[model samples]
Target: MSAIQILDLSNNSLSGKIPTCMGSFSNLHVLDLQKNKLYGTIPGKFAKGSPLRTLNFNENELEGPIPRCLVNCTMLQVLDVGNNKVNDSFPCWLETLPELQVLVLHSNQFYSSVWVCSKTKHCFPKLKVFDLSNNRFGGPLPAWYFENLNAMKDVSEAGTELQYMGEGFHQDSITVTMKGFEFELVRIITAFTAIDFSNNYFYGEIPKVIGELDSLLYLNLSFNKVSSCIPSSLGNLSVLESLDLSSNKLVGKIPWQLTNLDFLGVLNLSENQLMGPIPRAPHFDTFGNTSYLGNLGLCRFPLSKECRSDETLQPPSKLEDDAKSSIGFGWKVVLIGYGCGMVFGLIMGYLVFSTGKPQWLIRIVEGEHRKKGRRPNKKRGGRRG
Candidate 1:
């Protein structure tokens, strides 16, 4: 056992606490004990100058904080403690491991803010995958971590033989959420870059610097309290395939610039306060109403509501509509009365002229003529007398 370079006791029915002496091997390079029924805390000691490169304790019942002494394994490259009960803050000290590449602490009780050491000029310089989802971490999104991911920004070497993270007797696997679905990648490529900070309490706007990761393939910051408009600079990620910013407090129009992402296969901006017409593009047309649901202000194609043009008149408010209705009804009533009176007068004229002269009509005319003639005769006779 002392000369063994790899120890893989994973995917078994093994239970009970991990042996403290498991870390005593000086030449051990890989220690995998995932998918088991193990309980209790991890061993607190690792031999100095240990050659251990991979330590995987995924899908176990392990509790308590991670062993601080594991830092002794300066050559550690992969550390996965996902789907466990480990309760601790962000392990910023892991930044010291120069060879460390993959760090996954998902689905754990890990709480508090993720702090980055100010003095560490190059943190996780070679890291390719960083997942902290389903944890209790709360605070503003850590922009410093994104700023220091120098590895993610670099373009993979072209025309070279593709290399995987683990290519030996033991293969490495990780659960990645893509297009709102979880998939376990049985083999990880060296160029694969992803950052998942979902299902947390992170607030504030997404850092514009996130667009600098041109090599990123997947980026999920969903299910948080993130607010404000999404950075238009995100259009710079030409290679990003999956982008999820759902269930946030974000408010604003979807940046038309995002249509530039030709490679984007999955996009989720639902449950936000976005408004205005959804950007028009061939890529956007592929998405359905679910992508923009919960945003009542949003309108256009894919949604049933049509966007209003600037020249279109706005509908009247309730009070204004009621007043206009009352005024219109009053004018209609007056017009109806005038029309009825005119019709009755014309009917009386037709009876007198069209059907020969009527007695009542003739009598009214004769009486008016007699009164006028008598007035003139009376005046002349009085002057002669």
Candidate 2:
């Protein structure tokens, strides 16, 4: 019926192309057919006055470029078509949607660098989550692209009120890449910011402008051809939680400035061309050997290879650790025995002196000497006979 707005047949065995007639539901807003056996491109027959707000075609066999007609729906907010066969270039035009919040084109054949639409102001200014990982995007990360991520720059309180990806008629859920896997987030809040551009052929220095995004919580640029020293400016991200730049050609020392990130929990700079001593701060120390593996040129605390100057290294080692344990046990035994003997001697001496040389107490003290004193007399008598 034209009156029906919400349609959700996702995760079913439905097959064949999405019915073009379904687009005639001018009142229809949310369409969710993800994780089904659906094939063919999205229908391009939506009405110009389309009220579609949320469109998710994730985890299907849908291929080809996204339907350009869907852009007619000016009210589009969330577009997630990840893990499909869609082979197309960057959809910079999607930035025109004023209310678009979440865009996921991960694990597809999307290629080329991202560009700004107007070049005068930010695009996707309200975008909270952007994932383009596992694609064919190449070239140095565009400077303007990072500059226009205005949403990533805006800091928000972590304990904000409850929220969801979309507020309109939708399936009420979407999948996002968290850490290194596809995770379905049932609810999303304002402070849940992340960027994952891993598994691409992107090369060149990571833009120092990335540090300007103070609200970024998770960032993964692993499995790329990125090179050059890590920008010391990244230390400015005081609240960032996870950072993965592993399996790249990145070189130079892990900046000591990174120690300033007190809230950093997960870090993987491993399998890189990095050298020199790793930063010696507490936060850097928490990460283990795996975080710095494959860097045979590296030296310092956590790694097995000691630095040229071991003064800066203070990693908890096994040999010295065993010595400390042995000394601790030996000293404890001595103290207990000495304490018991001192208490007994003091009590006996106090009883004899305080009781005016009490014979019983004095005899206990003199008993040893009395026996030796009598033994000498018996020896002299036997010698005289």
Candidate 3:
């Protein structure tokens, strides 16, 4: 297979270790072994200068530290190893890859302190899509992690006065097309990336700077120990499509400002200690019962139920009047009895009219009929005599 340019063994029953000799494919550009039963550590030398741009080994039982030799493959564009048993400190070596575009490391056993690139350092400079969700990484999110390429307007704006990497330093801009719509890629200047530190032991209020990333499309931080009022800054993500903050210790009413996010498609705030009427908005109207299922205090549209107004909660002026108007078991019984009596009376009247007739009425009608009959029976009797 040394002459093979692309080899795809994905979605097969292939088992055991990947052959170390397969790395001899010098012309290979894409190697896919996803959704297989392959087990054992990824061969370190498999990624060195093999022109491998896309390598996917997802949904396997591969374990141990990610092969550090992968860092040498500067031409690597997409690296997906999600849904595996790989355990390692954060792959800081990924920061050095200049052409790496998409990086997926979700659903693994990664545990580390906060990832912080110093203010002057360039980490994953060409990265367009990065997902590190469902891991055990903890600590406060570093500010310099997502350097906004768009924010660097000029040499002076970048604040290189502190430390210059030298002139002619330009960050390449990448364009991403998702859902058949083209979106100009903008780096995460603030904190809102598609980062999911959910289902872990993280705590503290969501940072206010998270809202500054206008390009963010997906954000999930549910199933954590986070508390405090949701920052109103979240409403600033105009491009945001999905936001999930469920099963947390968050408190207070949802910000009315969040209703302004017109493009938002999915919003989940369930199983939290939130209270107040659900905010009315076009986006809110689109959501169904699943969106707010676990929040007991949330009442209003989409839930198809409204909480009582202050005036409605007050007692009526007269208890007797209120009791009469209110529907109860006694009212139901009276209505049923009245209906039964009317039906029973109609049945009895019909039976009596059919079974009984007045003699005076019948005699008057028969007398008139006899006068018209004449004396026809007399002549017949004389002949018989």
Candidate 4:
């Protein structure tokens, strides 16, 4: 293998194909057969004058069509073949690799309406990191395809906001025209560039000019079928980090100005059906509860629940009349201590049965009832003596 430069047959148990005589190893730069079980078609003579920069056939079971003669290896950089089963499209012949940068074709089957470049004024020109995540690539995301990548500003640095085109706004080539769409200006400078057209089937509503792409970071359009709301101009991206709109069908609220995306980190608005309240701040108070799981009309403060009356944490009415005047003063102090313990136990049972029994136990029960009431009071007082 001409003193192999770097040929790590990754996770080997290597199966057929891939050995077009290892392209006569003209100093193979790097070729790692990732998670192998490799099948066919990837050796168009290792892209002609092979000095392959870095190529990893990820999780393979490789199918056809990705070897457009490896774009003649114009000093090919990194091209990762993600979880493969590679079907074709969008490989626009590796955008004519001019020292091609990192480009990972995610979970393949690439059908496409976009991603075309063959130097139409400048495409992939020294492209910086570009990922086609979870492919099945649909429409609407092609504002001049990375705005004529003039060597993508020598590997990223300008304005930013290329990551899958969430909210828009990039200035440079001067092609404004919002709403009806039409923006360019070299995608405004060009440092940021992550594009993941999430779990297929992309639908409408999510284009509030992607907040003019002020250099976005990561943005994922969660399991698709996208509906309305959530476009509070994405709080103008300001270098956004990660924002995933979970399983869609999206409804209202939750736009408390996206807490100004202060370099947000991984915020997934879970399963979506979105309602009101939730949306405190400090980026949703540091998000937890699995980023608002299955949003059942979302309540406030970390979803412990309690915010219905048309939500937004409804409370005022003088704070619900001061919580019903402190629950009516705790039921008027428990009904004045149970009506003063039932009038002090009915005045101690009316002075113990009207003060009749206790005169030293009534003189020992009147001497045992004067011997049984003294024979009925001494035969009626001894027949009146």
Q: Which candidate wins on lDDT? A: 1
lDDT of each: 0.86, 0.81, 0.68, 0.68
- Encode model 4's per-residue lDDT on 189-273: one tens digit a residue: 3354444557666666777755665555656777777788888877777667778888888898777667778788778888998
Clashing pairs in 2: none
> Which ten-residue region of model 1 has the weakest summed lDDT?
310-319
* Candidate 1: residue 96 Cα off by (Å): 1.3
Q: TM-score of every model?
A: 0.78, 0.76, 0.63, 0.31
Q: What is candidate 2's TM-score against the reference?
A: 0.76
After superposition, the stretches of candidate 3 with alpha carbons farther than 4 Å from their true spots are 46-50, 114-121, 147-194, 303-385
Which ranges in model 2 have alpha carbons more than 4 Å from their true place? 116-120, 157-159, 167-172, 310-385
TM-score of 4: 0.31
| Cα lDDT for residue 162, candidate 3 | 33
Tens-place lDDT per residue, model 2, 1-385, is: 8898888888899888888788778888888888898888877787787998878888888888987777788888778898888988888788877777778888888887765245747578778778888999888876777888888888765567665555443435667654466678766665677888889889999999999999988889999999999998888888898889999999987877788888898888889999877778766799898889998778877888877864465443346779999999999999999999999999977886787888776687699778777645787889998
Worst 10 residues of 2 by lDDT: 309-318
lDDT of 1 by residue, 1-385 (tens): 7899888998899999999888888788899998899999988778789988889999999999998888898888889999999999988788888888889999999998886456466888888889999998888866676888898899855357887787865577777877667798878888888999999999998999999988898999999999999898898998898899999999987877688899998889999999888887788689889889999888887989988885133334447789999999999999999999999999998897788989887899999988877745777889988
